[model samples]
Target: MMKKTISLLLMLCVIRSFSQDTTQQIMPGRQNAIHQQDKPYVILISADGFRSDFAKKYQAKNLIALGEQGVVADYMQPSFPSLTFPNHYTIVTGLYPAHHGLVDNSFYDRKRQQTYGMQDKKMVADPYWYGGTPLWVLAEQQQMIAASFYWVASEAPIQQLPPTYHYFYNEKISIDQRIETVKEWLALPRDKRPHFISFYFPEVDHAAHSFGPDSKETAEAVQFVDESIGKLQKVAAASGLPVNFVFVADHGMAKVDQQNTIPYPTIDTALFTINSGSAVLQLYAKDKNSILPFYENLKKNAVDYDVYLKSTMPASLHYSTDDDRYNRIGDIILLARLPKVFNRGGRPTGPGKHGFDPHYPDMRASFQAWGPAFKKGLQIQGFENIHVYPLIAEILGLQYDATKIDGKLETLKKIINTK
Candidate 1:
C-alpha cells in the first residue's frame, strides 16, 4: 500500500497535479444552511504551500493515517488567483475574493489610504478590507467560543466579533509553541474551550519558496511539519478532546527558478504599477489607456503570461464578479504559466511559488477530514475551498449571517457524517 501511494505521488509530481476527477457533483445554493450537528468541536489546520502529494511524497505518517481513517477528498481546488490571503479567508468566509474583499496578498483602498497587504501588520488587522464573517466570528456570535492561533483575518475583528482567543499574526512564533498553546486551549473544560479553532504553519511554504517544490528542502520541510502534526495528535489525545479535524493547504506550490526571470523593464511601468507577482499579478494602472501599451505587447508578442482587463478576465476566475470590483483589483490582472514567473523590477522568485490559476491540477490544495463529524475512509471528489465554511458552520451549530458568502453546504454532503 505504501509503495502504491509513493508511486502515485511520483506520478503527481511529474504532472504537478494530483486527484482523480469524478462525475459526482452537487450544487447547493447561497443563503442556505445545512443541518447542524450539536457541539462537535473542530480544529482546522492550514499548512501553507502544502501540495496535494507532498505528504505522501515525504511519508507523512500521521497525516496519512488520518486520511486513511477519515474522510478524504481527491483534492481541494483553491479559488482562482490562488494566492494565500485570498484563499485562506475564502475557506473561512465561504466567499470568493470578488465577494469577500481580500482580493490579493496586496491591494489598495484609495479612500482609507489603506493597503491590504500580507506583510503590513496594520493593513492585515483593518476590518475595512475584509468582507463577510469569518467562521470564528460567526461561531462567537452564536454563543460559542472560537479561537485562531494564526489564520488570516484572525488578527482582525471582522463584522465586529473577534474570536474569543485570537492571536495577532506573527511569523516568528515557532510551530511547537503554537501547538502547545492549542493543546492548552483544548484541555480547557468543554464550556470554556473554543468550539472552533484554527492553526497555521508556514514552514513548508517558507522552505518551498527558498528551495524549489521538487527540492530536498521542501521534503525536509514536509517532514518537519508532519512530525509537528504527530505531536499535535498526541496532545489532542492527551486532552481527551472530542474535536473533529480538517487539514488543509491554502494552495499548492509550483517550481520556478529564482535566477531565471524576465526583466521587469520589459513591461511599461508608467501605465501601471505592479501590485503583485509570480504565477499571478494584479496591476493598478494609472488609467485604462496606460494599460494599452502592454496589452498590445502581450497580444502582439508571444508572451509566456496571459493578461486581461479586470472586467475581461476569464469569467471562470470569478475575479470580476461586478463592475465595481475594478477598484479593488485594479484595471488589469496577469497570470503566469507554470515554469514562467514575472520579475517585478528584480523581484526574485525562489524555488517555488503559488498564486496560479486555481484550476490547474498542480495548483490544487490538500483537504482531509477526520473524527466524529466525518465519514471514515471515504475518498470523494474534489471541490472548491469555498464550501469549507458551511461545513465548519454546521459542525459548530452556528446560526451565521451569510450575506456575502458564496459557499453552500448541500454540495458537500458526501463528506459530512452526523452527530
Candidate 2:
C-alpha cells in the first residue's frame, strides 16, 4: 500500500508540474514573421537507421561537407523506446513517446480498447493514435505550404489538417525519384513551394537489417545514400533557390545474433501479451495485480535483459504517463543487455535492431544541418533529438499551441546566427 501510494503521488506531482508550466503562451524569442515573397524554406530528411559514425567511418563526402559547412552534432540521441515511428514523431513534435501516446511502435490502447501497430494501414493512419501535432500540420495552419515524401502521421489529417503535398507512406519509392520530387516542389514558384518539407529513405535501415551493420551490403547502401545527397544538392543548385537542409536518422542499429535466440518457452504465454521488439520486449498482464507475482518469478529466470515496471522506469527516459489519460504503455518493459537477443516469441531475428535503452551508445541517432540560418562550421557534442522541433519552428517563425515543450529553443539557438 505504501509503495503504491508513493508511486501515485509521484505521478500526480509530474502531471501537476506540467500543467502549471509556461507552455500555455507564445514563446518570447520568436523571430519576425517570414515575408510572403522571401519565406525561409527548410527541408528535413531522415536517413532511416543511419548511425552517427557512418559519415566519418565511410567517408561520406556530401554528408561530411554538410557538417563542415554548417552545424553538426557529434550525435543526436533518440527518445526512449527508440523505435522508428515514435522517435520520428518526437523529432517533429518535441514530445517523448509516452507523452505523445505512442508508447510503442505497436501496443494496445486501453482507453479505446483497440490495438495500434504500424503494420496495419488503417491503424497507422488513425488520427487517434497520433496525439501531438507534427510540423507539417502546423505548417498548413500558418498558410505556408509543406510537403512530405513519407513521414509518420503525415498520411492522416492530424488536427483536421495535413501537409499540402502529403502522400501515403511508401518505402519502396526509389531514392532518385524522391530527390527529383523535392526538387520539383522547390522549382515551383516561391509561393507554391513548401516552406517546410520532409523526406524519408529506408535503404540504409533495410540493408542493415538484411545484412549486419558491418556487412558490405550495408556499406554499399550508405554509399548510395551519400551519392543521392549529391543529387539533391545538384537539383537545388540548378533551381536557383535558397534552402536550408537538416538530415537526421530515427535511431542507430545493433547486431542481434540469430543463432543465440532466447525463446522463453517455459513461461506461460497466457498470463500476458508479450510484444516482442527483438531487441526489447513489452509485457501487458491480463490482470494488473498479477504483475508483481509474475515479476518475482520472472526475475528468478531472467537472463540477458533487465525488467522495469512502469513506475520504476529510469527517470531519464521520461516514459511514465498518467494511465487514466492513456494506458498503452506496458506494465513491464524488457531491455536487452548489449548485443543480446531475447527472441522468445519466435519473431524474425534480423541482424540489426533498435528499440533498446535510448542511452545505449549504439542507439544514438544523427543530426546535421547546413544553410544560411545556421552558423558556418559549427560542431557541437550530442544532444537530445527532441530539440529539433524548436529549431525548425525558430527558423520558420512558427507559432505552436505548446507553451512548453520538451525541446528548448535556447538549447538550439547557439547554432543559429544572430545577425
Candidate 3:
C-alpha cells in the first residue's frame, strides 16, 4: 500500500507540471482584476504608412470614433529609419529594431554580399533571422490560438511554429476581402475562435509610395481603410464578444521630387548601386577601405546624398548594425535631405517614399484602442514603437518584462483597469 501511494504522488506531480506549462499566461491580467471575460481577444490592425496628418486632414470617422470612445496615444514615433519590417517586429517582440531584426526595408549582408528585400517572402521569412518572442508565438506557447492577415513577418515561423492561421500576402485580394477574413475567424465557434488576430492594410502604403503621402490619392486610401474599420466595428458589436482592437501604423510617408535623387556613375561596372525612389543605395565593397572612399565620393562628387557606415549609423536613430537587420542594410546608409535625382545605372524611379529617421513628425505612427477593457477618453502621448509589445502583453494578461523594451507600460496603465 505504501509503494502504491508513493507512485500515485509522483504521477500527480508530473501531470501538474504539464498542465501548468499549457495554461500559464493564457489570458492577460490587470494588477488587481482578472478580467471576467470568457476568453479575451485582440484584433491588431496595421495601417501601413499611415500618418496622423491623414487622420487630421481627411476625416477618418471610424478611427476618430474609436479614439474618442476608447484610447488614443497622441502619437507613436516609430523606431529608426521609420521603415516597415523593423517597426512591425518591434510592435510584437517589445524589442528595438536592433534586438528583433528586420533592420530596414532593403539591406545588404556584408559577409554574404546579398540584399534582402521585404517583398521577397522566400528569403525574408527565415525564422533564424529574427530574435525574441513574437506575440503570436508567445500566445501559441501558452496554448492560445492566433491568426494574422498580410502583416510583416507573418509568413515567417516564430519559435519553430506558425500562427494558427495566416495569409501569405496575396496582393490580388481586395482590402474588403481582408476585412471579411478577419470577421470570419472572429465568428468561429467559441472553441475554435482565435484568441488573438492581426490585420494589415497595405493600400495606403502602396499609394503613398507611388504618389506622395500628402497627395489626394493617399488621402483616398486612408478613407477607404477607415470605412473598412467601420465595418469591423459593426461586426464586433453585433457579435457582443469581449475583444481589444488595436490600430497601429508601421511608419509614415515622405514626399520627394527631382531634388531627392542622385545619380551613381553612368557606367554599370557595379562597385556600388542605388535602388532609386528614396535615395537609398547598396554598395559592394571590394574591401573595408572602399566604404570610406565611396562615402567621400558621394559627398564631394555627387553632392546630393548623405552617407554613413551601417555599423556607425547616427546615434539618434536608435538602430543596430552588424545584426540581422544591418546585414540587409547597405554598407553605406544614404539619406537625401535636399531634392535631387539618384540613380546607380541612371534609371529613375518613384516620386515619394519614407524609411529615413523616425524623429521626423511625418514618420510618427498612429495609435488607437477600443474595447471593454480600455478606459474611455484616456489619452497618451510620446509613445514609441517598442512600447507596444509590453502594452499588448498587459492587455493579454501575460507576464512580460517591460524593462527589456524601449516602450513603457505605465503610460498605458491609465487606460487599463489595474484592479
Best by lDDT: 2
- For residues 112-131, could you state the per-residue lDDT of candidate 3 as single tens digits? 65666775555656675677
**Candidate 3 clash figure, as a count:** 16
Candidate 2, residue 165: Cα displacement in angstroms equals: 0.3
- Candidate 1: regions farther than 4 A off: 1-38, 257-259, 265-271, 289-294, 321-326, 346-348, 401-403
What is the lDDT of every predicted structure here?
Answer: 0.76, 0.78, 0.70
Across 225-343, the per-residue lDDT of candidate 1 in tens digits comes to 88887888788778765788889999998877567675543546766676756776666766667777767676566377777777688877888738334258766677777777878
In model 1, the worst 10-residue window by lDDT is: 22-31
Which is the winner by TM-score between candidate 2 and candidate 3?
A: 2
Worst 10 residues of 2 by lDDT: 23-32
TM-score of each model, in listed order: 0.86, 0.88, 0.82
Best by TM-score: 2
* Candidate 3 lDDT score relative to the true structure: 0.70
lDDT of 2: 0.78
Judge candidate 1 against the unseen true structure and give its global Cα lDDT, from 0 to 1: 0.76
Model 1 residue 362 CA deviation (Å) reads 1.8
